[model samples]
Each structure stands twice: as C-alpha cells, then as structure tokens.
Target: MENTMVFEEPMTAEKCSGHLSSVEDAIYVIGGKWKLKIIIALHENGNIRFNELQRIVAGISARVLSNELKDLELNGFVKRVVHAEQMPVVVEYISTDYSRTLKPVIMALSEWGRKHKKNIREDLF
Candidate 1:
C-alpha cells in the first residue's frame, strides 16, 4: 500500500518553544468522544436547543453534553443563543463556519473507517 504522508526525521526543540496554546485548545474542543458528533448534528441542522442536541446524540449524559457544548462555544466552533420565545426560554446551539471547517477531517475519518471495516468484514468471511 502507498503511504499518504511523508515521514521526516524527528526534530529537537531549542531551550524555548513556541506556544501551542491555540492548537492545544482546538484539539481539546474537538478531541473528545462526543464533540464531533455534536458538531455533525449542528451542521446538519441549522440550530437546536439544549434538549434537541441531547436527543440528537443519544447515549450522552446531560452533564457531558453541556460540557461539550461549552467547549465548542469557547473554541468558536459553535454559537449559543437564547431563543426569543414565550415565558419559557431555551438555549440554542448553532455551528459556525469554523465548525464546518471540520468537514474534511470528518470525511477523512469516515473514509478511513469504511476501509478498515470493509477489510475486516472481508477477512471474517
């Protein structure tokens, strides 16, 4: 099989290294188990309330979902808004283009998973 990425020798850092704060923050926002699925839900549907997002991604606890949404909002991947409705109000989650930017990453992961599944299935039979 052909390799997709070129490998290079390891690097050594100087006494001081550039801050990886933003990069680390981005990874932290999207690196969790359920964050990507949450983004996918928002991307597919323009906006959704808290309960709606919880429904969209089943098997996720309320606390976990809340944390993921907070992380997404902090990282600029999602925007949280208050609904202009009646007495009872709701908080909605919407994906920003920044979240949509994850399309290629998600697509690549899906393609890789599909290939792995196919190979495994073939091997089984």
Candidate 2:
C-alpha cells in the first residue's frame, strides 16, 4: 500500500484573509534587514557581548544594533543575560528556542537566494 495526501484548491476568502494576517504578523516581527542578520549571527556564535555582536553582524551601528536587540528580546526571539555579580558587570545575548524555529526558514531562503543570484548572473551574460 502507498500513502498519499491531497491538497484543496481555491482557498476560501476567509482562509486567505487569515493567512494574510498571519504573514503580516510574521513580517512585522522579523521583516527588517538587520533583525534576521542579528538573529543569524547570534545563532552561529552562541552567547556574545554587544560590542562583539556588532563586530560579527558587520556594518550595523551600535545604535541600530541596540534597538534591534531590544526588539528581538521583546518578541521572544532572543534573551539578554546579565552577570551583575561579576566584576564590571557582564552582559550577553543568546538566541531563544523560539528563534530556533527559524532554522528551516533560513535554510529555504538561503537556497532560494543562491538560485536567484545564479539565475540573475546567467541572464546578465
């Protein structure tokens, strides 16, 4: 026996509306240029300090990085941990489990981006 699944066509207006709302919410959370870059850097480097993070993401100003980190923390995608008990007070940012959910999404986007770049290059020739 073989297992198969079928999808329905012609989505209802209600379903389409709901989907659009969901996509909007997602974009609002992670849409900007720096947000995903910050997230990706954090994921790759593990916990790191603010200055180090700025260095890793590259081209992002301290002001912009500070704002983005606050946004990510608020959205449950990143965690800011402070070691106040230590000398001079240490701080680090870590990617939350919620952020891990974006792994597949990042992978898919990377693949599509490579293909798109290649196609564009070929077209230019």
Candidate 3:
C-alpha cells in the first residue's frame, strides 16, 4: 500500500475559519502568475542562476522574473545568493527550507493537473 498523508478529522467551525484564513494568506503570498512556477523551478533545480531560471520558466521576461524572485525572497520562500568570486559575479536563487513545506501541496497540484489534462483530452476526443 502507498503511504499517503491524510487529515482524518473533520474540520470544526473554528478550524474551518482558520484554514480559510491560512489558505488566503498562502494565496496572497504565492498568488502571482509566476510565483509558484518560480518556486517549483527553484525547488527542482536547486541553486540556479538568474538567466537559467528565466530560461527554465519560459515566457517570463527578465523584468518579471526579477520582480517575482524579489517577491519570493521577500516572502521567505527563496534565497538569493551572490557569488563575487566569479569574474563578472553571479547571482543564484535557491529554495528555502520553509519553501519545502509546500512540497506536498505542489505534488497534489501536479497530480490533479495530470488528471485534469487527461480528462480534458478524453472529453475532447
């Protein structure tokens, strides 16, 4: 049997309100069009340079990537490291341990996305 995390208890009224607030807070932090994608890329690639991240994310302009990375760093989900040893200097972005807390959420979303795509494909055909 596969081990899966589950919430066994039903949410109480207070718990429901707290959960909703927490979800709203989370959405506010990572709510932008590019924030979660940027986080996922950093999580997958580990430490990545700015240019590389832009390439990996695709369709994001340098300005937008810069803005999003700053937001992620500000939100404590990502860290920006600068290496001065390189000739031209280098900057890299890495996911924080705090960001790892979202792994399960990301995985669940990925699983749902796969199923959604399959359902759409089936419906179309």
Each model's TM-score, in the order given? 0.78, 0.90, 0.82
Question: Which residue pairs clash within candidate 1?
Answer: none
Instruction: Give each model's clash number.
Output: 0, 0, 0
Off by over 4 Å in 2: 1-7
Regions of model 3 farther than 4 Å from truth: 1-13
The best-first sequence of candidates by TM-score reads: 2, 3, 1
lDDT of each: 0.84, 0.94, 0.91
Which RMSD values do the candidates have, in order?
3.8, 4.9, 4.1
Top-scoring candidate (lDDT) = 2
Residue 124 in model 2: lDDT: 100
Q: Model 3 misses residue 44 by how many Å?
A: 1.8
Cα lDDT tens digits for candidate 2, 1-125: 23554448777899889989999999999999899999999999999999999999889999999999999999999999999999999999999999999999889999979988998999998
User: Tens-digit lDDT track for model 1 on 30-73?
Assistant: 88799899999999988898888898899999999998888888
**Alpha-carbon shift of residue 122 in model 1 (angstroms):** 2.1
Give RMSD (Å) of candidate 1 vs. truth.
3.8
lDDT comparing candidate 1 with the true structure: 0.84
After superposing all C-alphas onto the true structure, candidate 3 shows an RMSD in angstroms of 4.1
